[model samples]
Target: MTTLPASAHWQPALGGDGFVEGIDDIRQAIAIILRTPVGSDPLRPDFGSRVWQYLDWPIDRARPHVVRETVEAIRRWEPRVKVTRVVVALDAEAALKITAYFRLASSGPEISAEVRPK
Candidate 1:
């Protein structure tokens, strides 16, 4: 496998290059997209989800809105995967927990990823 420069975050795999591929790559992309605030990237003003907006909102309202936005953004940006479900939860410390279920575009295998905005 070719070693690729880390795009959003550094993730080292055992006995493998730092390159992200297949399902893992999709997961990483989702994490980066979710964490990035909209308009943060001047080149792509709509490249990110709106999860950051709900960060300070009440949990009851924020949870559903965040989940909807997460699903919409992933579907729009990440065409390599078909999003099946999105779950939003708040931990005791008020941290957002986002879990997304999806299937690869080329293959039908189901996969899940968790994304928490930094």
Candidate 2:
């Protein structure tokens, strides 16, 4: 299990988006991973997630896909944490919203990040 660097645990200050250290950084990183389409990056073809493919798919049908894609991507890319749960839902606009819950692999409180993958 990888632990966040000592500075990272207390480094981030509140930003305009209300993101802080540990949570926001991890959240943002996960969001980026999920937003990126596999094979888009020329150098690392396998550095992204497949969640975006299901964007056009119906939410009910896409839920499992989102959950699976996110869990695996997080597991592979972010060694600092382990995904515990991923919830998929639709907003009033019918857009998809993915909320993921995870904790540091080295042990810590569970943290959740909500990402509306485009």
Provide TM-scores for the models. 0.81, 0.82
Each prediction's Cα lDDT score? 0.82, 0.83
lDDT of 1 by residue, 29-62 (tens): 8888888888999999988988899988888889
Regions of model 1 farther than 4 Å from truth: 1-17
Measured by TM-score, how close is model 1 to the native structure? 0.81
After superposing all C-alphas onto the true structure, candidate 2 shows an RMSD in angstroms of: 5.6
* Candidate that scores best on lDDT: 2
Model 2: lDDT of residue 11: 37
lDDT of 2 by residue, 39-110 (tens): 999999999899988999977888998899999998998887889999999988899998889998889898
> Number of clashes in model 2?
0
| Predicted model with the maximum TM-score | 2
